[model samples]
Target: MAKQKIRKGDLVQVIAGKDKGLQGKVIQSLPRDGKVIVEGVNRVKKHTKVGQTARGSQTGGIITTEAPIQVSNVMLVVEHEGKKVVTRVGFRREEQERTLPDGSKKTVTRSVRFAKKTGEAI
Candidate 1:
């Protein structure tokens, strides 16, 4: 399996296509397909066939729901210079767990930086 930089729940914005400038949380990521489903983005209507035995005899209508957009068309939203900016993945040095003065260990987290601009971690 190929490793994917973007994961579910990551806030991303559409950088191209009809949904450009729209930002939403990632519902899922399909690395194999190079596509991602975002909340409230690239919404398309889905039609469902109604059956006679349906509850309340309600007729199904067009349902608007988000569809997956190509990963290349979206950019991850990150913070930069006190402002929100699109960012590409850049890894920092891995840090080990730190022990506090009170004898407690904390999970270490590395900083995330912009791929093109800053070299420093988050």
Candidate 2:
């Protein structure tokens, strides 16, 4: 599987659903599931149980929490053409460098180019 361009802390905007057009920072990302939980978005309430034996806790009430949204439902917010926009992957940069498995220099290169649209370090 390919790595994701969006990270846990990336700023993203919801592009679909009732939360469309809403923007927030990513709180968590599940690359395997291609879902991300944005802060203060997709809020859902969860029922809680109050136990008589509690440590300095008096009451238990409904807990509101953010739920994970599909990654496709959100777009990576990026600055392009002097405007903030959502973008896809572009060209990749070629660099002359390789990590050695045994702590030895195996290969060396010069420059690497990355996708300007997605800001991915390709």
Candidate 3:
């Protein structure tokens, strides 16, 4: 599987579907499904039967909640200049030196995500 560019808590803008152009923070990321649930976007109504719970409390009715949308339909939002703008995400590997218990130094590479538009680490 490929690495997911969008993660939970990222600000993103919808570029397709009925919620196009809407910006919201990502509430959840489903990398396996290639979908993300954004706050205040792709809302869906769910109906349930009214029934009693173990505590005898009523628990069932119409509920409105966010629905997952395709990851490709959204673009990551980042601060560029002095304004917020949507941009593509890119990955870069950074190397760092680490000291071992044997008094030896080793170099390790880690993947980092960045905002392509501003070339800034995210």
Candidate 4:
């Protein structure tokens, strides 16, 4: 599996495709397929036949919903200065000292993500 940089509920902008320049929040991420479903992006319409079932009556017609787009097509949106900006993401390892139960301090390394532009945590 690949590392997922774009997570759910993240605001992103479409960099390619017909929805270029459109911005929306990520609703779902499909890391296995390298795709993500963003709010109001890559919408597809489906037509269904009406049927009666035990659960409920189905009267489906033309329904539109978001579809998955390649992860590379979207970029994370971050607030910079007073406006939103798009930048590449990078990870860093930070070392921290922790006190164990034995009263001995041990150094631990943790992974952190930040924007490559301003070095701000995502």
**TM-score of every model?**
0.71, 0.69, 0.88, 0.85
Q: For candidate 3, lDDT tens digit of each residue in 42-74? A: 999999899999998999899999999999999
User: Mind giving the per-residue lDDT tens digits that candidate 4 earns over 1-122?
Assistant: 76988989999999999999999999999999999999999999988787777888667678898989999999998999998999878889988899999999999998988888888988
- Candidate closest to the true structure, highest lDDT: 3
Of models 1 and 4, which has the larger lDDT? 4
Error of 1 at 67 (Å): 0.8
User: In candidate 2, what are the lDDT values of residues 1-122, reduced to their tens digit?
Assistant: 76666778877889899899999999999999888999988999998787655466566679999999998898777666677776654445455656688877655545443446657553
- Candidate lDDT values, in order: 0.80, 0.77, 0.95, 0.91
* Candidate 3 Cα RMSD after full superposition onto the native fold (Å): 1.9
Clash pairs (backbone) in predicted model 2: 93-113, 96-108, 96-109
Q: In model 4, what is the error at residue 65, expressed in angstroms? A: 0.5
lDDT score for residue 11 of model 1:
87
Clash total of candidate 1:
1
Q: How many clashes in candidate 3?
A: 0
Candidate 4 accuracy as TM-score = 0.85
Put the candidates in TM-score order, highest first: 3, 4, 1, 2
